[model samples]
Target: MPPGPERFVGRERELRELRADIDTPSLDALRGRPAATCRVLLVAGRPGSGRTALALRLAREQAARYPEGLLYAALTDPQGEPRAAREVAAQLLRGLGREADDDPEAALREALRERRVLLVLDDAASGEQVAPLLPHGETALVVATSRGPLAGVADVRPCTLGGLQSAACVELLAQAIGSTRVTCDPRAAETLAERCGGSPAALRLMAGWLADRPGMSVTDAVRVLPDDDATPLERAFGVVAAQLPGPAARLMRMLVLAPGALVDAHLASALAGCALEAARDALEDFARYGLLRRDPGPGAGTEPAAYRVAGWAVPLLRDALEAGERAEEVRLARARMLERTVRLVRACAASAAAPDEAATDEVPLALRFADREAASGWLRRRLPELLGAARIAVADGELDTLARRLASAAVLALDAHGQAAPERYELHGLLLEVAERRGPDRERAAALINLGDLDAAAGRTKDAVARYRAALDAARAGRDAFTLGRALEALGDSHLELGDRERAADWYGRALAQRGERGELADAARLHTRLALLHTDDGRRDAALREWRAAAAAYRRLRDHAGYAATLAEVALAQEVSGAAEESLRTGQEALRWARQADDARLQRVVLLGMARVLERLGDTEGARLQREAADGLAGPGDARDS
Candidate 1:
């Protein structure tokens, strides 16, 4: 496996005794290969009896004996559906960094023929699923976990995992809540663990409940967790659900319908149409009963709030929601949550805008952020939940408008922060689908350009050109000059990458014309720099110089001191690259002065270093030495280059 829990509680004696059945000595481990299998240690038990947990612990304990690698595969998907044997085999093969399109199982067996590897097949639905997965090598070990004995399989050594020891159960509780609470009354703690039937899951649920109520005694738990001679594993979840407060109990029902695994106080609040504190209290109640696990999310590090639906609790919550909640109630809850998500996503994007742009974007005072940095952090932190919400909205028939709005806001925020290319590619595709189906032709054009940029970044120049072409159509239909410029610029870049220099130049000229009409000085300056780079890299020295002058003129007119300084540094680098030492020195000096005025440390360092190189080339050794000292004093941890 992927390493099991860092802290394993209980089952010490079980692990010690099971080693006799599972562990093989060094000499005996190298015996001739079996006809079809190696030693199979099947750990079997009831679902909530800690079967998988015990198997994980046992398999991990043998790490030294099988150092080749530990390959694990869950025979069942997360939805409790059985996975095909071949699929599981393919996953195992991939884990070993080997693959066979024709036959993964055979390829896997060959790969592990003489290797001492640990193969963990978890949650085997039947003997048929387990049979095909077994390695036919004597040196390999198969540690399979199942809810019951694997029928029709012979000569398999078995280990039965069950309830925790009473002492271990108490220790588990103490670990979850605290020793002080358990130590306050050891007798009551023992009773509480005993009442939980020593079932680890039950003990954990009971522990979470007590942890929520610090003042409540373990005796109170012993009483509340009922002991009617029925198995706690079978009854604890329902009993806890029944015992929660009315709103919390209802919230528990609604939680089952959540689109994603994660939930925050804000999402929970909207789901129930309740106050934030009320939703938080409900989440606390659900978490206390193990219906939801406290997972690290957006709030975990920054806000101290978040929970994920516990996998085991899904079916139970679904049953409860079916029995107690109405369809309309669930629908309205989803609507409330979706609308809230749209508003929040829009505000998050707006929060990162400059004051001039933000004036036109009015957000609620409660949702607005102080500045771009804060908004960027919020976007990074909440991106997962936002994605989840977007998925739900896109799928909901009644939420198309909200979904389209969310897609627009989220895509821009992701672009602003320079998030992952793959993720942006996926989200941009979704935005395109939503925008096309939902109206607003301009957004469709924007989405096409956004996705085209991703495709270009991944070296899919032809695909990017295709998208840019489609974007040109959409932009023309919508009369959006800004998006039109973007499409034209992307086409130019893609064509350049494909070595169609003449076509690239034509697109660049068209894009510059569009940018001029659009009246975005920043855009014009950026385009000038792009053309400068293309000319410089193509050895068109005079054309590159003209483009750099245009970029500088645009930056100066815009009063962008930092932009002007950065542009001059680029010019200095270009001059040095073309062997104009005197021009490079003069340009570097101008760059340093502007950088000082803009207080741009990064640009200052770049210019200083550029000047140092020019001085060295001119044989002015002392001047170069002084420039080197100045550059060294401005050095930072990761400022390796101008970028």
Candidate 2:
């Protein structure tokens, strides 16, 4: 679950009642019920009334009961528009590791059926929008926060929220500025809370108004604080907006236009076209004014504070400075930021020790890192925002070139990390959409292949094969041999995983033909190894030996000792299984030599054990014993995995 706001007060009774409701026995545990309606709890409130914060806090508190883990989905985009049910369900399916980007409602239901996951659907628009997305099981809990009533969204308990208690509101104010100011004038604090209508958001703005003007007392602020036909939140907003410094106000307006969940000093600088330090100062001002919340995560500080645009202040920012007034400035700023992201992503990808051809391009010196570890850390740290930026680019459909570049680079940087499954699904899905819409043929082919690779990793072999086949068509349309070969190789891998060795062999053969025509030693080694494995599985002795020898020769040409050793080890095993003990022993000895040269102790130990078996078969019992002893001595305590 997402972190709730700091200094949350009140809502205690509502929480208790809702907790009881969630724990209460559901009337619809069995399937074929009216969807997930009974399993849901809708928390409804007006804007700035703490609806989202309350829902998040409750979700976190109740997380442990739902062993399947908690899922948080913001039903609205950053712009506050209600996203389509299809889009929301697709993201939910992706988050659940079920990749169905198009028409994902049924898949989402299938994913949530019988799963005890807690789903927090935040900022829902109405009943019609939320109705289609409820979970299908009583064991699963759905906590939906909405500004609207969501009248028929669910047949569950409803928690209607209002302003905080006056005392709670005063305590909230005291927490922000010091207790001394409120305690210094008790009557005025009560009046201030009442005047702000006990809304946390408005009170926070008032606190900022007073905090920024330290010399002014609570009484003085109250004297000038507008009390008009406008809502208290709006009146408080009027005071803050009227007093904001030029830079801070400008930064706030552009920030709503800034894509993603964060706005750092560098991003602020880009958006405002100001110096970094100046942007930092303005961000500090925004934080103090409660226009942005200081992120409580790691690396929190003034020089590099990551501020989340306060959800309540979004409309205020738009009202203060409409996006249309300075549309070009926002566009240029976003473009500049996107360009920087492309270079940064490329540089990180290039940091891999054996970078492939596409990711080896030169970038700005500043973007380059000292080592692979540092590059990986940099890339992973910024991956979320980088991906968010790509989504925005696609939604906006303007920065096609930069968005496509970011697609490949982002996937490259993330593909190696197994824990990045969610991001991989999201990025590839977005890339596939973008590529199909307007991207060049090469990008389209690459996107399909990458998505297919993800599906293959997830054990969706049939789906992967479908995507790989599409990628082949795209690659052929572009006449790009590299992507075509890649598609063939991926298809081979998926078929192999599916236990269709014949089809796998065919795909590998096609891929090898292309690789030999256009690529290098590495591709040859890989294809030969794949073919050798397939042949070995089929018990084709001569064919397996020929492919293994070819693989070893390719590896030797490339001077890859590790690959050569592994291939030789395979050859020894095949010989041993085929009753050629003496030849097997010789091959194992050669493999052990190359394994030692490669400094791969595990590979060496494996060869030693295989040689031991060969020695025993040859009636050399003492030699077998010695080889076993050597292999055992090389094994670490934790290295008990099957060789």
Candidate 3:
């Protein structure tokens, strides 16, 4: 019987516990109970820990107890969705004698009562999800392998699995390559086993990998293991990547750059820089040969399975991603990934909703669940990768679309993670050189504009003004209206910082007129808000109020709450300056509400402080003190500049 297939790596304790549970008569009676009863056995372990191997071994070894048949199914939910319970039940029933058209759950329960089968559910995701398909019948046995705890099943025997012992790991490697070769260099074999953390899937992957590479010593393979202790799977991945063909090697690198390890044929083709047919063939070959793990994509319907380098292979995969490719290519690939990553981060950074894709070239990775916590977590984990890409792009003098896009991504990423001040001010400095080199005109202007904005935020008014002038000249030479508008607004803001209200108003007016003529409502709204502030500084309260109202209207049309609240706050300031005490109180209250609604605590504090000054001027000492206290409370702990 081939010993029902070697359980092949480790978890002796888990096997013993499972054996004990199976032998227990009370548990057996529950499983064998009349219709409407079921027993579920969950085998939980990390990826590559041999959960599936163990489950299969246990199921086959106990086959004599299940005289009816052995039924197996893989539950791979489509991307962006959970697998349908009904669909899983239907597949289970069809594996037996039931028809596909029959009510799945009902038919499943019926079939379970009819036979004593060994059911193996492979790659199960969770407990609640797999529990429904459990069978009732004394002679039947159910084995499920998953990444997490399964819930709510009677007489449940939970088997927690782990990697192999050193000896088993070495034996696995020996069986994979040659026992004599591995045994000859026990030290090298021990190193490989330790590097793989005794993971059977890892061991198997390494076996296949080493089998192909005659020149590579087991010690050489261990050297490339990912440095992170928590990700042993990736260390094994690095070993596998060093063994792939050119196309497969490139494919592995590109796949790691993808978000969530998911990619379709279209994306895979783009990544490989090849035709879809070739990409599909390569993907199939990879899966067939076990170089990659395949799972059906979310909402894939009947589409081909999406592939990822096995978890054990991630380290190898990332090493491949970082290796061989010229520094320039690696930088560009990272730039692309960050372009997508930053878009996602920016979308989540907002206190309100995401913007439309058509309005901007950068679009966010939309979340079906709208989970802020999850989005934030993804950004934090990938921060190093994104930062490395930005640094690489700036270092390589290849300032093309890729470089510019990378700079934008870097800026947004910094902002999203709240690292805009001192931590990322250096990024702005790096981008300046790339922009200056990449541009004959438009690129130069855009880069200068961004540099000016960064400088202004850092309180370098003089440097900001200089960069804005350079941007303005480049914008005029290139005849780029948007660039010119941005430069004009930036220059105007710099002037305002120097208390040059007249110059600020003039620049803001020009920007407002140009953006208005261009029908760029969003840009026009921003310019109008700046003009409102300049007018207020110039003591023209009525003009400031008018500009703010118009700005707010424009921002509202564009669904830009950040811009709207800023303009509204200016209007409140105008009311206060014009000595309209009652109106100032009402407008200030409204402005504060809008600022909070916009989810910008920094802007909210600024507005509250302004309101405090207004209340003091109007002789409401109590109200003034309360507003000041509230603003101070909000400004607690963090850098006052971060918000």
Candidate 4:
């Protein structure tokens, strides 16, 4: 369930309305049978208006009615990216003690059809995301909370929440401080509440400010608060921020300029140029003072908590960051953030590809990871922050080097993790703008290559080919051999996708020759794999097998288990096609072992399915059946095959 309302104040009427909707039987249920339609209750409100708290409270109240389960899913990351629907479905399936099957949505719908589940989807980006996750059964209810009305969703009971009532605001203040303190100055309490504009978040922050000073009277508190053109929430934030010591206050301002919504102590340390311990202390103090909110760490307290600037306080903080003397400070802080972010991303990419003993010495101690999984997890959590910081750097102009490096590192990390998304393309476009304006030739080449990759992924082959050609020109101008090779390879891929076999082969051959001359084994291996695919597509099985073998050898030398496993699977398939059943089965088993060692479930499933087909061809029916079952078990709810 979402966190309980902290000193939850008014909204009795809204609560009653929510209760009535949940308690009353649906029209279909009233007709003596349940219907295949979900009842959606949308609780919409402004930021800091307590929408999440109200929705969670309603979910808690109706928990008993949903005996099968109460499932809560946050539909967006802190940076406001809408999570993929398949990922959300997997979470729901896990909560229900079920593994994700191929077709997670169908699996979830089936489960909901047989059970009474109440889903509370918080911070949804749009109605489209909510629509796919809705339970199509009368026995289930969905309470969706968003900053907007979710306007286009059909059959929703929309409740748009505003600030608290005057009396409730005072009551909330009293609860935070004490009844005695508030009642001692009832009129002053009411005045303060009015000044806060009845926003529970603002009121609570003000209450914390007052509660910190034992002898500060309510009148005095109201007197010290800012009265300006800013909104009540902003003024309230200003009032609280004023009380913080210099370090805390400065950190608060810098945080507003921090990329994305949340920050860890390591990032804070980088921004502050202070020790990690000091940054952590300042962050904790901000949380205590109600200027920040602490998010629970990953699983079972293994990690330290992360902090986010309270939503209501952000505008005021940003205002402070941009005002007069703080502008330079904000710029410097963002530069530091960009440098550190670039290093972290590079470290993650290196760690994911292959561990480097010397690389550890180069990475900051705070950014070093235990293994690939840890590095990947950190990259996933901070992707939006890294992208946001890169944009800030690009716009700022002074940090062009850091910006270029950050963009390059981010692209590498995203590629390594197979997490390329449309947002990344947008970020690459921003990088391209920066490159065209003031970046070095090498940076310009890198940006063009990254943009080309995005265009190819989006199926804009012509656009990708154009970008790659531009990249090749930049690379040649800069005399950057590595980027030259990369651009050629990318161009080859674009032409391949466009069915221009001759052009594709010419580009691939040039890229391969360049990589081989440079002793860039990884790039050479990837090129060989691509060439093998082209060969196989053209029915040149012998040539394809030769290329796959070379690629596998290079991958093994690099200790790239995932790549080697994939190449081995292709080899197995080729062997099977050539009537070498025993050799095919042997290679398939070896591929499966490597996939397991790499902990890549997708690769494991691919190998298993391939093995199953080979086994079937070899007339081993029982073995084939077992392999197919194993493959099915490893398939995720969102597997492309299911789609």
Give the top-scoring candidate (TM-score): 2
For model 3, give the 10-residue run with minimal summed lDDT.
295-304
lDDT of 2 by residue, 1-643 (tens): 5567767888898999898887666555444344444378989888788888888888888878888878877777667888778777866765665555445777787778888888889888877777788766566888888875777754667899988998888888788888999899878988988888878788888988898777878898788787888898889988887777777767777787666557777667777788877888888877766677665332211233467787778787777766334667667777776766666666666676465543444654444566667666555445556778888777778887777777767877665432353567778888888888987888789888888887887778899999999999999999988899889998888888888889889999999888888757799789998898888878898899989999999999899999999999999998898888899989999999999999998888899989988998999999989998889888978776334
Using lDDT, give the best candidate's number.
Answer: 4
Tens-digit lDDT track of model 3 for 1-643: 1122222555677888888877566554546645344445778888668776677778877888888887766554322234556667765654463443335676686677757787877667666666677665555677777777766666667887666789888877777677777866789899878877877766666676676666766766566665576556665655566657788778767765544454545446656676667777777655533445554222121224456444434545565666767767765655555444444435545412344423233332222213434434444433433444565455556534554565566566556545433325445565666656655788778777877876786678999999899999989999998799888888787888898878888988988888999999988887777777667767777888898899989987987777777777777777777778678778778778878888888888888888888788878999888887788778857636222
Residues 1-643 of candidate 1: C-alpha lDDT, one tens digit per residue? 5445333688877787668866553333455534457677788876667766677787778988999988777776534678778767766765665533446677777888888898888778888988777777567888888888888665577788877787888888888888998898899988877777777777777776677678888888877776686678646775577767788778877775565456767677778888887988788767655566555324421235567665566667777878888878887888887776776667766666667877534676645665677666666645645765776777776677777767767787776655542345657777888888876889899889888887887778899999999999999999988788889988998999999987887898888878888688898898898889888878898888888888988898999999998888888887888889999999989989999999977778878988989999999989988987888778898766332
lDDT of 2: 0.78
Candidate 4 — number of clashing residue pairs?
0
> By lDDT, is 1 or 3 better?
1
Error at 534, model 3, angstroms: 81
Error of 1 at 403 (Å): 2.7
What's the true lDDT of residue 390 in model 2?
Answer: 89
Q: TM-scores across all candidates?
A: 0.58, 0.69, 0.42, 0.66
Model 3 stretches with alpha carbons more than 4 Å out: 1-7, 10-13, 27-36, 76-81, 242-245, 252-643
Give the lowest summed-lDDT range of ten residues in model 1.
294-303
Order of all candidates by lDDT, from best down to worst? 4, 2, 1, 3
TM-score winner between candidates 1 and 4: 4
Task: Give the Å shift of residue 146 in candidate 3.
Answer: 2.4
Error of 3 at 57 (Å): 2.1
